[model samples]
Target: MAQTDTPGEHASVLRLPGIVLGVGLGGFADGILLHQLLQWHHMLTSTDQDRIGVKYYDPDTVPGLRMNTVWDGIFHTVCWLAVLTGLAILYARVTQDRRRVWTSRVLWGWMLVGWGLFNLVEGVLDHHVLGIHHVYAGDGQLWWDLAFLLMGALLVGGALLLQRGGRPLALPAGAPGPDAR
Candidate 1:
């Protein structure tokens, strides 16, 4: 990453905010769609004592759903904090070329990268390692979980390609920034 003696020009500094923002937003999308609207799974919906030795919480039951909902709310709260942190970082770093950076494909690409990372990490931890919940519970749930990871990988790949096309910001590290567009 090039440094123009300017903090905003630093490659990682510029990209970090966008990715963090994307992670939070992506998590919100997942929680809302899969957990709330679709009623697919909750924080501990997949727990089975035999498998993981954790008490199962049946999402169909009121008490069980209540517990799951509480955990889900906590997850969302963390995501909200992440979004705030990301925006705060962006507001601090991008002191110039506000319009350009805001519209640049690089920023968008970084955001996608963040979202993909969130999906990949969360899918692995929650759906696979922890087995707390699946993308969709019940039969063939593994397929759903795998599909989620695949989408994340695709998003990251596509985002990298998109970033390559975003000139100026996309310029190789150590290169000078192009004049304001």
Candidate 2:
């Protein structure tokens, strides 16, 4: 006996679930480490607390002013929304391209690239030199900040690697050789 392909198996493997898993993992790291472990008060804001009608104090002077996990929740919420939206798009695309060999891999690669870009831009503008935020606002925050950027780069690079490796595995049952396409 021979195994037969199902109607929706490809879409099931490639769509909403995949996006949710990838984005959830990445978002959890940001919420837990960057927003919670590090005392970065303003994780989602672009301005100083004083300028935004919130109190401000030098870490030395302020006694209890430490990391705020509230913003972590907010960041996580946003990440969830992004992942949901990406999942919707992935579902649609995969449905339309169910028979296409590279559709799923390409979709996954694109999502990874988008997530990395988000991290790089947000990390630099909000957490780095602007001082709007930090991965850890406490003492010696530079290394944490660098690590965040490095993680983003790694995500993007890993996606590219997957895209390359996926090509040979994407052929349909009776498809001709690569050169034919």
Candidate 3:
């Protein structure tokens, strides 16, 4: 007889979807709040305003605004892809193992981790290292950058605590965890 269910086939599968979703949402939040709403920065806004290839565009000019808008569209596309990919992975995992609970502690914990990871990577690479953009590109930019990193650290730390405090979310043997049918 063929095996029907594989609950433990892929350990750590439950957290994958949440993490991806968080990462995508985090990206969306950054793009919306910082780039769109506050108008603090754009995708290619940087200190080196005259860089070749990816030249910086002023937010005031129509051509410059168009350039930044294009780059922003690209960024949003990537975030959208992340969400779709996460959903695909989640569907596959859920079908494979019906016991995976959507609201488990592990899922929430990893989601926070993923969001934090996004902020850390984006903040460090774009703001500090590459100078591509900062949370607020102006005098005392370092303060904003540090604050962003601090927020990321807090998210990661909080996630670890949540994961540690909760009991492992697993249905007991012979128990039906979810009803797909």
Which of the numbered candidates is closest to the native, going by highest TM-score? 1
**Clash count (model 3, backbone only):** 0
Encode model 2's per-residue lDDT on 16-100: one tens digit a residue: 4444545655766666665556545545333353234434434433332343335556678887787776666544534333445
Ranking by TM-score: 1, 3, 2
Best by lDDT: 1
Tell me the tens digit of each residue's lDDT in model 1 across 1-181.
3433443344455588989998998899999998999989888888872247678878788999899999999999989998998889887876655667767777788888888999999999889888888998778988999999999999899987776565554444554432131
TM-score of model 1 vs. true structure: 0.84
Q: Which ten residues in a row have the lowest lDDT in candidate 2?
A: 1-10
After superposition of all CA atoms, the RMSD between model 1 and the true structure is 4.3
Compare candidates 1 and 2 on lDDT and give the better one: 1
Best-to-worst lDDT order:
1, 3, 2
After superposing candidate 2 on the true structure, give the runs of residues whose Cα lies further than 4 Å from its correct spot. 1-25, 37-67, 96-107, 168-181
Each prediction's whole-model lDDT (CA): 0.79, 0.54, 0.72
CA error at residue 144 for candidate 2, angstroms: 2.2
What is the number of backbone collisions in each predicted candidate, taken in the order shown? Answer: 1, 1, 0
RMSD of each: 4.3, 8.0, 4.8
TM-score of each: 0.84, 0.57, 0.80
